[model samples]
Target: MAGKSKSLKWFGKAVTAKMEQAQILGVNQTMAASAAEAKQNHTWQNRTGTLEGSIDIAEYAKAEADGVHGTWGARDIAYARIHELGGVIKPKRAKALAIPDPKKAGGVILVQSVTIPARPYLRPAADTQYPKLASRIRKAFEKASKKK
Candidate 1:
């Protein structure tokens, strides 16, 4: 019984370390995929060339053990949320804007409202990577467990 308990404790430590490594790999992969997708779709124009470049991964600690956890996403880009989930843009008090009509030369028109559609980049990237995530996690776990 004593020997069995010791082996079990060792197994737990190994598993925890492997899980932490797997979490890091998963987050990095997801962040890269998301950034690529955002750039490919051009959700945000590269005016200063910082929007797409700002995507990154953040590491955290797990609740159950000393294992690591992580999250991959963009930070501090104002339009990131709108492009990801999508929402409505309505003028205050239903105010309208007058702009020169392109079709009619020198003619002006009133624009009532503009609807911005959601061009989901992050979710699609994650979805594309989802099928391989399990395999990745398994590989990370196996590789870590093999180490001393």
Candidate 2:
């Protein structure tokens, strides 16, 4: 009976460890998928290649027995903000820039008001992946639990 109890305790610990590993794996997979989807969306939305290539995943915190934490985004891209949560991009009044006109000879054109419509890609990617992630995590947990 003492031997039986010891074996059971070991099995319990093993199961817990497996669950933690599964959770971390799931988080990593989700972050990768989210980053990929965001990158693809950036292309589909007709964005510059800079923003598309900037999408990436990073582990924000150490994984523990409970779970893992991480972040996926274009952290290095400066224009990520304008694409993610868009805002007006009006030209400075004092700095009214001039551009060479192709239609005329040595003529220049003054900069004018510009508006950028919101083309959110990250949040939408997260929203689309959220529903499927729960099931993926469950599957990962089950797979880990079944492993010896």
Candidate 3:
């Protein structure tokens, strides 16, 4: 986990990790954002034999333009700086809110649910489900159902 926490080195010491992430990886902040985008969606040397589809090079180009972060932790402070520019900042100066309500509940995050559409990139499989995503859920459900 040393490798992982290394990436987290840049993460905020202020609020929740996620809020910290948003605080950092906003649009237009390339250096800060590249890590999050790399984690979210990225591509690399494609060696697949089946040469049959298009590439979302535009997305890759945009994302890669920011540059690949070597470690996830190191990108955190940069991400937070980028988050401030976008106006969707996760307030850092405030105290932590572990307890319920009264004092901690102040401002809000982005209310508008913006939908970032997903497009296929680096087609590795013949069927196109992301290989790294949640695959075992359906299998678990089926396995559990047989006992009931």
TM-score for all models, in order of appearance: 0.63, 0.71, 0.14
lDDT of 3 by residue, 1-148 (tens): 5556433455244334333233233222332243344333434333441221221112221223344222221222343222222333333555432234454577444322333233332222212332322233334334444553
Can you tell me which runs of candidate 3 are displaced by over 4 Å? 1-132
Q: Give stretches of model 2 more than 4 Å off.
A: 1-10, 43-48, 64-66, 90-113
Better of 1 and 2 by TM-score: 2
Encode model 2's per-residue lDDT on 1-148: one tens digit a residue: 5556433335777776676767667777777888888877653455358778778885543475546777788878777888778776656665665668999999988776445567788998788776776677789889876766
TM-score of 1: 0.63
Worst 10 residues of 1 by lDDT: 58-67
Q: Which 10-residue span in candidate 2 carries the lowest summed lDDT?
A: 1-10
Clash pairs, candidate 1, are: none
* Local distance difference test, candidate 1: 0.67
Candidate 3 accuracy as TM-score: 0.14
Instruction: lDDT winner between 1 and 2, please give it.
Output: 2
Q: Arrange candidates by TM-score, highest first: which order?
A: 2, 1, 3
